[model samples]
Target chain A: MMDLQVKLPGLNLKNPVMPASGCFGFGKEYSRFYDLSLLGAVMMKAATGTERLGNPTPRVAETSSGMLNAIGLQNPGVDKIIAEEVPFLAQYDTEIIANIAGSTIEEYKEVAKKFNDAPEVKAFELNISCPNVKEGGIQFGTDPDMAKEVTTIVKRASDKPVYVKLSPNVSNIVAMAKAVEEAGADGLTMINTLTGMQIHLPSRRPLIANKTGGLSGAAIKPIAIRMIYEVREQVNLPIIGMGGIETAEDVLEFLLAGANAVAVGTANFQNPLVMPEIINELPKTLEKYGFSSVHDAIGKAVFV
Target chain B: MRKVEMKLVYARQIAEDTIEMKLEDNYITQIAEPGQFIYIALPNFTLRRPISIADVDREQKQLTILFKIFGRGTASFAAYEPGMIVDCIGPNGNGFPFDTDKMEKVLLIGGGIGVPPLYYLGKKLKSKGIEVTSILGYQTAAQVFYEEEFNQLGETIVVTDDGSYGEKGYVTDIITDSFNFDLYYSCGPTGMLRALTSKLQDKKGYISLEERMGCGVGACAACVVSTKNEQGYLKICHDGPVFPAKEVIL
Candidate 1:
């Protein structure tokens, strides 16, 4: 049997595939389609200090091979998430990685601190790279200093491991990676959606309500692979790579590009069963490429 | 919702820019409610198009989706022929509530392509022996469909903007106090819904909304609508494609 298991910081994943944060809500929606335990971990939606209603309607626009979204981090507050969502997720055997976000550093720390009491949360994915929100999301992501500062604060407040998500919209991605690593981050999730927009020809205006949205789908895979390869070369931290993953072959590509585990984002919208289908196909894919296990494929394409 | 490779049994244009597609081996039809929708994944498109289920013949194991070509994704449906497999996922979102025990006289209002689901809804309500009065609005006579089918159920009135068919004005223009429908179910463009809600203030009714959607399963909050409650917002893809008129702000 091929060993699909992988370990990263506080997560001992049965497989390397998981639904990316924001794409997979709080796990209740997907649990109806398939078993949640089939996944390595469930990355819950980004939670803030207070409940946010998010942006207006017409938040999504379809492009060529991708779609743009400006959901603005609509979620129940961290307290409700801890009280309600966490317990529902606790019923499953999978590890829970809470994605914490806020508009201010204090809010970030406050959200992280609240999850400290919830034992179901195995790790925290510091969402400093969400492109949809106007405040606090990509602000800290693009700037090296703010990225490092927020990482330090969130890491200090949480007992569980913190994996800082990196934005692709930055000019110096290596600097951002190094900044978070220097701030004592446990790991990294590279390449959040690139800021983009679409125009309705008849209306003669931007299609999305926010005027801009994050671009995600098969279009962003090459960019994610490139970023993961670049960041893996500079930092010695485990990476959870994602951008536009949809297939098991895509999973193998990210694993070879230096991601310890991979997350499935926009693809879930296309096919709800995509994650498990990819998981089922992964062992054969790994075997077809002559890799004995998941860890064996990590960074194989990266030449020092 | 289970994903299945549904085989296209047939495809034909029901009206101008509108086509009716029938797919078989659809497990979704067995449990699909009238107002629920399905996501159809097309070639080269990043997102699936959420189409309302127009009707279902469970014994024959067939389901119908009637849509108008508004975008490239929907336009591609016309290219599909018999025996072709279409990837789909659904019976998604809540359908119009049809509790026959409480409802006696019901009004079904639909506009253009929005008129399809009401046919199935009308059939179900008619089966329960409830009186159904339908107000179907179309841009012109060329765009009208399912009028005869709705007529078989009960009284059905068709209205067009240009007076090309039936009555002369919008569906709201034909509505009067004489109908006295106990409840209403409507699916249409936003303007019609707004006008209907305003005309019938504090009346108990349900309206299905349309928006650009990501995941039809409610994971992605891409298709959210504002509400009058403290929860503030609800996802249109999951929480509803159908909602009680008074609960939503728009």
Candidate 2:
């Protein structure tokens, strides 16, 4: 049997299958379908210091192979998440990666510091690259200096590991990756949805409420894979790869492409049990690739 | 939620542009409730189309969904036959409250495609011996349907914008003091729900919402609505396609 265990900084995961933030809502919704303990880790929704109402109506729109969403980080504040969602997730035997987004650096630092006291929290997935919101999301990710600044404050605020999420909309992903790494990021999550939009031909209006939203799913998989390949080549930190991951084969491909683990984002909505399905299929999948363990497949594309 | 390969039992043009379909499946029907919806997987379409549950025959293990041929998905659905098989995932989201027994003089109001789920809600309420009064709205006389089925349950009132039907104006135009209703349930476009909430002051009500959804389940935060309280956005898919009329902002 091949070993499926992998580690990102100080956090250890039994398998490399976890749902991306926003796709999995604090594990409350999916728990009704299946036990969340079946997966390696749980990445909660993007939280901020204050409660956000998000965008207006028509937040999502479907595309050819994927969908676009402008949810605008509609979380119930960091305190409520800690007081409510965090304790609920502690029941499952999994690493809890708290994903936080902020309109300002102080907000990021406040969220990081607040989560620091929770022993159940395993890591901080710093979201400097969400395209749906107007402030403090993709603005921070595209710029090297801003990305470093956010990473620096977050890393300093928390004793836990900080994995910075990268935006695929940027011109140079490697530069962004190196910037965060240089700013003392423990790890990285590459390719957080490409910036995209669709228009309603009949009404002559934008499909989503935000007009332009972040696109994720089978449509963005190619871009995510390419970015992971490029960023993985330059950054020595462990990378969490995601985008359009719908099957076990997709997970193995990300693993081969140098991701320490892979996140199933848009696919989770289609099938609630996708994480368990991928985790169950990972062992035999690695065997087919002639690898004894998941660790053996990391950055294997370089040798190929 | 289980994905059932539902055999299309019947598909008929119920209106000028709408088609009511009955699918033979047991996966979601056992758990299906009023105001809950299903995600239909159409051939060649990557994303499943979310349609509300119009009615269900529990013993027959059959559930019905009504769709208007507005887009490619529904256009394809409109062309489906009686023998075609479709994949459906449901019964998704929290349905309307079947447990609340406080309201006696209940009124059900809906507009356009939103009128269907109210049919199920009306039926369920009537089964409990509660008096149900249904008010349905359409753009014109040709777009209206379910009048016969609704009449069998309780008082059925039809309103057409062009004044070709029972009432001359919108559904809310007739929902004044004349109805003397203590409870109200509604579903429709954002403008209608907002109007209903404002017009039906002092009356307790529930409104089912329709939003562009990612997952018909609560996993995707796309189908969220602002709540009246400080909670901000609440998911329409999970928290409700149906919510307390006073709780939701619109």
Candidate 3:
């Protein structure tokens, strides 16, 4: 049997498959379908200091091979998540990565501090690049200095490892990646949703209520893979690659592209049981490729 | 939560733009309630189209969904025929709240595609022996539906914007001319809802607000509705797609 036990700097995942934040919720609804512990980890939905109502509808608009969403970081403030969601997640035998977002640095620090106190939380996936909201959304990611500052503040506030998630809607992803690394982020989650838009022809208005939204799913896989490879070349830190990963084959592609772990996002909407299916198929795909362990495939295609 | 693939047993073009689909799924029919919706998957499209459960036939293990052809996904759904199997995620969102014993006379008002949920609600209310009065609104007479089906249960009033149907005005106008009801329920366009709220401000009622949803279970907060209550925003998917008419801001 191939050893699939690959460890990041501060996070030890059983395998390299995790359900992306926002897509998986708190994992309660999905548990009714299957055991959530079968996967590597569960990233909690993005949380902010104050509870946000999110954007107005229509929030989602379908595109070719993918969809656009403007969910706007709608979460039940940090306190409720820690009290309600975290305790519930603790019941499962899986790592919990608290995905957090904030409108300002103080908000980020406060949330990180809360997660630090909760022993059930394994890591903090700092979301500095959510593209749906108007304020503090993607602003921290587009600028290297702002990204570094948010990373530094979060790192200081939490004892747990911080995985800074990056935005694909930027001029230089490598610069942004290196900035977070220098600011003391333990790992990186490259390529958050890409900025996109859709129009309603009959009404002559944007299809989504927010006018613009973050595009995710099969169409974004290529762009995400390219960015992961680019960031891997610049930073030696472990990377969590995601965006449009639906099948086991897609997971392998991200693994080969240099992601220490992979996150399945929009695919959950298509099939709630997709994560388990991908996890079950991972071993067979590794064996077929003659890789003894999942680590053997990590970044294997980057040099080639 | 079990993902059961259901075969389409029948498909009919019910009105000018509405298409009604009946699928053979026991699980869906048994648990489905009024105001809850289903996510119909069209393999050709990436995202699933959400349609409200218009009616359910438990004995036949058939659940019906009424949809209007608004986009490519819905247009494709309207074209689906019998014997075709489609993936469905079900019974989602909070359904309409009605206390049959407490409510003696109930009034159900619907406009356009918003009329589907009221059909299911009327069926349930009728089963409890509660008197159901329905007012269905359409753009024109050719677009009207459920008048006959509703008549079998209780009294039904049909209305069209133009002078082409039963009442030559809005459904709310027809409602005003009718008897005072103990409880009122409505679903429709924002303007129609606004008119209903204004007309029934002093009355007890509930309105199901439609917003674009992501996960439909309140996780994404995509379908939040602004309320006048202490809680700034309520998740339409979880807290309610159904809310008290007075609490809703718009």
Candidate 4:
């Protein structure tokens, strides 16, 4: 039997495939199609201190081989998620990774600290890279100092391991990764969506209501591989790499580029069964490339 | 909510810029309801297009959809042939509320592309021995479609914006107090729905909505709309594409 298991900081993943944060709501919607336990871990949507209404309609627009979305982190504050969503996920065997985001450091720490008591939540994926919202998100993401500060505060407040999610919009990704690592982040989730926009030709205005949104899907895979390859050499932390992953081949590509595990984002919108389909195919895919196991392939393409 | 690769049984242009295609899928045809839509995955497009089920033939195991060439995604359907396959996830979102016993003289008001699902609902209601009247509005005579199909079911009215068809005005112009309906179902532009709901307040009605969607499964929260409910919001892709006209704020 092939070993598909992978171990990140606080997550002992049965397989390297899990849905990216925002794409899979709270696991309630998708539970109708398949079992939630089939996934290695469930990355809950970014939760803020207070309930967020998100942006207006037409928040999503299709691009070349990707899509742009400005969902603006529309989540029911941390209290509701912990009270309702976490307990529902606790029934499943999969690990739950809380993705915490906020407009202020106090809010971020508060959200993180609240989840520490929840036995279902195994770790925290610090969301400093969400590009859709007006404040906190993308602001801390683009700057090295802000990213480091948020990571430090959240890490200090939370009992579970904290992984800093990195944004691709930064000019110096290496600097950002190193800053978070120095701030005592346990792991990293790299290559958040690139900032992008689309225009409706007839209206002569932006298609997305936010005018700008985060671009994700198959089109952004190469950029993810390149970034993971760059960061794996310098940053001494496990990575939960994501961006445009569709097939099992994409999972193997992410692993070889130094990702300990992979999260699928926009591809879930394409095929709801995508994550499990990729999980079933991972063993054969890993063997086809002459890798014995998932761990055997991590960073195979990266040079020290 | 299952994924299947439906084989196109036939593809033909039913109207100017509008094409009608029939796909064969036993699973979908068996479960698909009147107002529910299928999210189709085209070859080159990143996002799936949510098209309503115009009609379903259970015995033949076929589903039909009538779509206009609105954009590049819809235009891709022009290349599909009878033997080709289309991958899609279906019978998604809440269909039109047909369980109510109050529906007697049912009125279906649809405009532009919104007329498709109403055709299915009209057929179902007619089979139940209920009186059905349809007012289908189009931009012009060239844009009109399914009038004959709807006419066979009951009294059908066709109106065009340019007076190039049956009547000169919108569907609302023909909706007078003389046409008494116990229950009504409407699918059209937001403006038409808002006007119709306000004009016929305190009456029981269901409205089908459209929005740019992702996931089409209520997970992405990309296609949510505000509601008067305590929750303050609902997802258009899952909670509805069909909703009680009164439950929605619009």
TM-score of each: 0.98, 0.94, 0.96, 0.98
Per-residue C-alpha lDDT of model 4 across residues B169-236, encoded as one tens digit per residue: 98889989899889999999999999989988878899999999999999999998889878867999
lDDT of 2 by residue, A185-207 (tens): 99999779887889999899999
Q: What are the chain A TM-scores of the candidates, in order?
A: 0.99, 0.98, 0.98, 0.98
Error of 1 at A35 (Å): 0.9
What is chain B's TM-score across the candidates, in the order shown? Answer: 0.98, 0.96, 0.95, 0.98
lDDT of 1 by residue, B1-250 (tens): 7788888998999899999999887488799999998888998898999999999999988999999988888878888999999998888899998789998999999998889888889999999999999999999999989988888989889999999999999989988887788999999999999999988776799999999999888988999888988778888989999999999988
Instruction: Label model 1 with its docking quality class.
Output: high
- Which stretches in model 1 have alpha-carbon errors above 4 Å? A302-304
Q: Where does candidate 3 stray beyond 4 Å?
A: A302-304
lDDT of 1 by residue, A60-169 (tens): 99998899999999998999999999999899989999999999999999999999878889999999998888788899999999999999998888889999999999
User: Scored by Cα lDDT, where does model 2 land?
Assistant: 0.87
Sorted by DockQ, highest first, which candidate order results? 1, 4, 2, 3
TM-score of model 3 (CA atoms): 0.96
lDDT per residue (tens digit) for residues A112-202 in model 3: 9988899999999999999987778589989999999999999888789999999999989999999999999899997789899999898
- Error (Å) of candidate 1 at residue A292 is 0.7
Residue-wise lDDT of candidate 2 within B18-54, one digit each (tens)? Answer: 9999988877877799999988877656567889999
Candidate 3 C-alpha lDDT tens digits along B106-200:
88999999998888888999899889888889999888878899898788889899969888899777765447789999999989999999988
Candidates' C-alpha lDDT: 0.91, 0.87, 0.86, 0.92
**True lDDT of residue A43, candidate 2:** 90
